[model samples]
Target: MSGQNAVREFTAQMSVREGRWRLYVALLNTTEQWPEHRFGHSVPTFMDRTDALSVLGFAPVPGAEWEWTEDSETPDDPASPVVLIAAIRVCSWSGVSV
Candidate 1:
C-alpha cells in the first residue's frame, strides 16, 4: 500500500472515548515499505481531535475543537518506556496538551 493510503487507513481506525474527556488513539506506521530506507520505521502515535486536525493539516470541523495530552511512563524494566497520547477536551477545543 502507498504511504498516504496507509496513513489514511490508520486515521480511519481511530476510536473516540467519551466521559470527562473525549480522545482518540491511532497507531501510525512511520516507515516506508522498504526497511532499508531511512523512513522505514513504525511507531504508535496517539492523536486527539486537535492533533488529528494538525496532522490532517486543515481547519477543524465546527464543534470539533478539543485538547489532548500525551502521557508517557517509564517501564519497570527501565529499558522500555510506555508512551500514551490522550485527548483532553477543553473549552471548545482550545488546544491539545501533547
Candidate 2:
C-alpha cells in the first residue's frame, strides 16, 4: 500500500469561536474496503484547500488543485452531534480511496 489516498466526496461544516472562524469537520467518505468515517477537528478557517490534508494523515497535495464542489452554512451543530470540521476529498490516510 502507498502512503496516500483520495476523497471522492467531501462534506464539512463551519464554526466560530473567540472571534475566530474554524472548520468543523464532521463526515468523511471511505473506500470500498471501509465504511465512511466520521472525524472531528477545530481547524482555523483556511482559504487553502489542502490545509486539512496532512493533519488527517494524508501525504501531500496542492491545496489549490482542490475545487470546492459544495459549501453552505450549517446550523446543525448545536442541534445535533456536530463539532469542528477539517475534511479531505478523494482519499483517506489509510491508503483508501474515499
Candidate 3:
C-alpha cells in the first residue's frame, strides 16, 4: 500500500460549455475504502493534450503517454457495465507508464 505505487483511476467526460470543450472527471473508487470520496470537477478547456494533463495535475512532459479508452455503455445508465466516456490513468511521468 505504498503511496508511490498507488494508481488513481478516473472517469472523464468531455462536453461543450460556452462553445468550448471542457473536461469533467470523477475518481473511481472501486473498493469504497474512502468514504470521503467526492464527485468530479469541472475543469476549464485546455489548449492542448499537454495543457489538459497539466490542468488535471499530471505534469506531463515530452513522450508522456496516456489514453482515453472508449466505454461502449452509456454513463447515465446505472445498469451499464462500463462508464468510461473517457478513461484516464494517472501514472508516473518521465512519461511512459500506463
Candidate 4:
C-alpha cells in the first residue's frame, strides 16, 4: 500500500492522572479510514487500559515492557512504579488474532 491507502503510524502511551492510569494514542495521520472519529478533537478515556486497547484494536507484544520514568509523579516513592508496555501490534479488524 502507498500514499492514501498506506497504513499510518501510531504510538501509544500511558500516564497516571489523579491516581488513575490513562491510555493515550497518537492520532492517525489520515482520518479517512476512521470517519467515526473526528480530527482535532478530544478522544474518550477508558478506566481500563485493556478496554481501551480492545476498542482501538491493538495489543502489546508478549514480554515487551518498560518503565515510564517520565510519568513518575513521585520519584522518591518506591511504592509507585510506572511500568508500561513497550511494543504493540495492530490487531485485525475483527478484533481477533493479534
Best by TM-score: 4
How does candidate 3 fare on TM-score? Answer: 0.35
Lowest lDDT sum, 10 consecutive residues, model 4, at 32-41
* Full ranking by TM-score: 4, 3, 2, 1
| Per-residue lDDT of candidate 3, residues 20-55 (tens digit) | 444544434443221111123443333354455555
Residue 45, model 1, lDDT: 41
Where model 2 places Cα greater than 4 Å from the true spot, the runs are: 1-8, 28-49, 58-90, 95-98
lDDT of 4 by residue, 1-98 (tens): 24534443445566445444555554455342431211122433332444666566654444544334443445678777654333233332332321
Report the number of the highest-lDDT candidate.
4
Instruction: Estimate candidate 2's alpha-carbon lDDT, on a 0 to 1 scale.
Output: 0.39
Local accuracy by lDDT, each model: 0.31, 0.39, 0.40, 0.43
* Model 2 per-residue lDDT tens digits across residues 1-98: 34244343343333444444443333435333323222244434343334544454443333524233332345544544333433444334544443
How well does candidate 2 match the true structure in TM-score terms? 0.30
What total of clashing residue pairs does each candidate reach? 7, 14, 0, 0
Cα deviation in Å at residue 8, candidate 4? 2.5
RMSD of 1: 13.8
Candidate 3 achieves a global lDDT of 0.40
